[model samples]
Target: MDTYAVHAEGLRKRYGGKDALAGFDLAVRRGTVQGLLGPNGAGKTTAVRILATLLRLDGGRATVAGLDVAKEPRAVRRRIGLAGQYAAVDQVLTGRQNLEMFGRLFHLDGRRARQRAAELLARFDLVDAADQGVEGYSGGMRRRLDLAASMILAPDVLFLDEPTTGLDPRGRGEVWDSVRALVADGTTVLLTTQYLDEADKLASQITVIDRGRAIADDTPDGLKSAVGGDRIEVVVGEAADIPRAWQVVAGVCREAPETDHGERRVHGLVHDRVAALTEAARRLRDEGVAVEDIGLRRPSLDDVFLRLTGHRTAEEKAGAAV
Candidate 1:
C-alpha cells in the first residue's frame, strides 16, 4: 500500500503580482488526519483547490489517492471527497436525496445511490432527519448533510476545509464526531481549520504556513512548545491591578510578563511550573491583589500563531483584504 494518500512538491501559483502558493509542499500519510493551518491568504485554500483539481497549478507535481491530479483529474475526483468551508447542498432537497444526488453525480446506479445515501445517513446519525428538507436543518445538520454527501461514494481521501466554521459548540462537536468516524473507517483526511481547539482535538499532525510558505509542522503538543513552555496566567480582580500583577508574575517567573489591562490578566513563562504558580499566588495574596483566576498552563495554538506569524489570525485576515 502507498504510505501517503496525498503528495505535492514545490507547488506554485501566482495571481497577477502576488503569489498565492509559493513552493508549497506537503505529504499526508494514509489513514490519518493532517491539519493544514495558516493565516488568511497563506495558500491553504489555493493548495486545496489545486489538489482537488478545482484549480490548476502553475508549477509542481501533485497527486491525490495515487493519481496525478493534473493528468488524471477524473480519477482523482472519483477517489476524493471535499466538503468545503460552506454547506453546498440544496435547501430544497432532503438529506437522503442530497446524498443520492451526489452518488448519481458520481455515476452510481439509482439503486446504488439510494443504498449509499441510506448507509451515509446511518453513519452520520442523520437517519432520523434523512427525509426532512435541508431547509429545515440546523447549521450542524446542514454541515453533517454536506459531509454525508461527500462520502456517498466513500472516497479514499477526504478534504475538509474549515468544515465547522460557523457551527456552535454542539454543532462543532457533531462535525468532529463525523470526521472521527470517517478516519476510523480508514479514510485519509486533510483538514483546514481556524479553530485551534478543533485541530488540537482531531488532527494527528499540524502544518502551519505563512506568506504562502510552510513555517511549522508538528503535533499539537509540539506546536504549543514552539511558543513557550509552561506559563503562569493570573486574572486580577481590577484592571488597575494589572501592573501589580505583571510585576508579581515577572518577579516570580524571572521573565518578562505579558499583560492585558482590559482583562487584568498577566502571564509569563517559567522553567519551574510548580514554584512559579505557588510563588505567584503567595505574592498576590501578600500584595493584596484580589485574584479572579490563576493557573500554570501550556501555550495554546493561538499563542503559537501570534508568536510564529507576528500577528493573530484575525489581523492576518484583515491584511489579506488590503
Candidate 2:
C-alpha cells in the first residue's frame, strides 16, 4: 500500500477562463491532519472536491487509500467520507434516523446500523437530542450530525471543508473536539479552513494556496519563522516620525515600513526583541514624538499570509474589498 493516505500530482481544475486549481500537488500521510489555507479563489474548495471524488480533475492524478481518484473513484469513495461547507442531513428525519440511514447506505446490517447510530449520537453529545428532527436542530447541532453521518462506515480517510464556518465559539469547540476524537482513533484527515487558528490547532502540516498555486507548504512554525522570528509593532503620532524610528531600529530589522498608514510597524527576525523596542522608544523620545503602543510578538499565520500571498484570508479580503 502507498504510505500516504492521499496524494496528488499536477492537480488542475478550471471554470470558465479561470483556473480553480492550477498544477497543484499535495501529500497527506496516514493518521495525520493536513490543513489547506488560502485567500478566496485560492482553490482550497476545488482541491477538496476533487480529492473527495465529487468533481473529476481536469488534469493530473490523485489517490486516496491507494485507490486512484480518477480511474477507481468508487473504491476511493468507499474508503472516504466528505463533510462540506454546508451541513447535509435530512431535515425531515430525526438525528438518529439520519445517521441510521447513512449506515444503511454504507451497507451496514440494520442491527449494526442501529448500534453505530447510537454510538455516534453519544460520541458527538447528541444522545439527548437524537430523536429530534434535524430541521429543529441548531446550526451547531446540525453540523455535528452531518459529521456523524460521514463516519457511519468508519472511513479510513475523511475530508472536512470549512467545517467550522457559521459556528459560534462553543460550536467551533465542539467540532474541534470531534476532530480530535477522530484523529485519536487513527483516521487520516484532509481539512480546509479560512480560519488560521483552526489550522494552528488542528493541522499537523499546512499548505497555503493562492490563485490556484501553492505559495508555501510546511509545519505552521516553519512557515511563521520563514516570514520573520518576532515582530515589533510601533504606533507613532506622525507619519513623518517613521524614518527617524527606522534609523535607530533598522539594523536588526529584516523588513521595515517606509510608509505609514495611521500606524507604522517594523517587523523582522531580531536577535533581541526587547533591545529593538528600547531603541525605538529612545529614538522617538529624542524626536519629541509620543509613542502610542509598542510591543514584541511572534509572527502569526496572518503575517505569513500577508508576506507570501500579498493578501489576507478570504473573509478579511472580502471585507477589505468592500
lDDT scores in order: 0.90, 0.86
Q: How accurate is candidate 1 locally (lDDT)?
A: 0.90
List candidate 2 stretches off by more than 4 Å: 16-18, 236-248, 251-261, 264-269, 278-290, 318-322
lDDT tens digits by residue: candidate 2, 1-322: 4779999999999899789989998989999899998887789989999999999899999999999999999988889989998998999999999999999999999999999999999989999999999999988899999999999888999999999998988889989989999989988999999988899999999999988888888999999999767766667666676676666557546665344565575444566788877876777678776666777889888888889888877667656899
Which pairs of residues collide in candidate 2?
A: none
Question: How high a TM-score does candidate 2 get?
Answer: 0.87
Candidate 1 Cα errors over 4 Å, as ranges: 237-247, 260-262, 315-322
Each candidate structure's TM-score, on Cα atoms with residue i matched to residue i, is: 0.90, 0.87
* RMSD (CA, Å), each prediction: 3.1, 2.8
Please report how far candidate 2 places residue 236 from its true position, in Å. 4.3
